[model samples]
Target: MPKVRVHNMTISLDGFSAGENQRIDAPFGDGVGWGDELHAWFVEASRDAAAGKTGTDVDYYVRGDENIGATIMGRNMFGPQRGPWQDESWKGWWGENPPYHHDVFVLTHHPRPKLEMDGGTTFHFTDDTPERVLERAFEAADGKDVRIGGGAAVVQQYLRAGLIDELHLVIAPLLIGRGERLLDNVAEGVEGYRVAEMVSSSSVTHVMLVRR
Candidate 1:
């Protein structure tokens, strides 16, 4: 069966997944000291892999994209746009070819037409519920797994609803005092899950949570 998974969600020691006031210039926002390094390990791992290096962190980083047929992300992850779509010109943060070479459903209140990009990547904007969007993602997955490509809030939605089958978090070594935090207000909903694996590299620590 296909599973819903969240991967490579790097958070700070202060539990912030993203900084405050997200903008086009500052993707993760400001006030996050050393918080930009959250995703540096993934980049480092990719570089290491290109140089024929293999380790636990490298393997974990590479594994996040395996068997992922469709992706679901919040509007924030899509861009800095908010409320209604005043300007429909902004495609996304990624240029011509995005990393997700599959159907990407972006959750938002305002609906828009589907965006077809190069490299077999397409963005479908919808205002549907998380469960409904997830179902659509599964249908598009075509027997493959569905990945929750998030910016904290979207991941929290599915997690609170107990929909995610696996959750992988990359714990950075820094601390952001404010901003969006992973697992925020999810104490009750997180009861059904447990940390199944924890592996630490020199820069960051990787933790995997699976349903009990």
Candidate 2:
């Protein structure tokens, strides 16, 4: 069966997954700037991957996309836009071709027409609950794993609902005083999951949690 997984989610030492005061200019917010320090390892790994290099710890983290058939993310992760559709001009943070080269379901209160990008990526906006969205995503995923790409709140929603099968968190060493935390108000919390793997790197610690 296809599992719902979260991969390469970077969080700070103080448990902030995203900094406060998010805007168009500051997508990840003002304080941490999309947790650059938190995602440095993956950035480097991505560069190496582009250069045809592999077998590094970062490579392992980057490879999680190989089995993903579709992705689910919050509107925040899509862009800084809020409320009703200001205009259809705002496609997303990513350029013409998004990194997610597959079906990407965006959770939002407002509805929008399906967006087709340069790559195989297509954005489908929905105002449904996590469970309903998951069902749709699974249908879109066709038997492959569905990845939950988030901005903390969306991940917490699914986590609380006990819908996530695996979670891969990259814990950076730095501490952001305040921001959106991933594990906050997560029902019974991570008690239902167990640490399946832990590896430490110079910039971050990779931890994989598998549902029991």
TM values, all candidates:
0.96, 0.95
Worst lDDT 10-window in candidate 1: 31-40
Q: lDDT tens string, model 2, 56-160?
A: 455666667878999999998998888998988889988999998999999999989999999899999999888999999999999999999997999998888
Clashes of each: 0, 0
> What does candidate 2 score on TM?
0.95
TM-score of model 1 vs. true structure:
0.96
Collision count of model 1? 0
Worst 10 residues of 2 by lDDT: 54-63
Error of 1 at 13 (Å): 1.0
Instruction: Write one digit per residue (lDDT tens) for candidate 1, span 1-212.
Output: 99999988889878888889877778788864322477778788878878889998788878899999999999988988789998999889889899899999999999899999999999999999999999999999999999999979999999889999999999889877889999897777799999999989988999999999
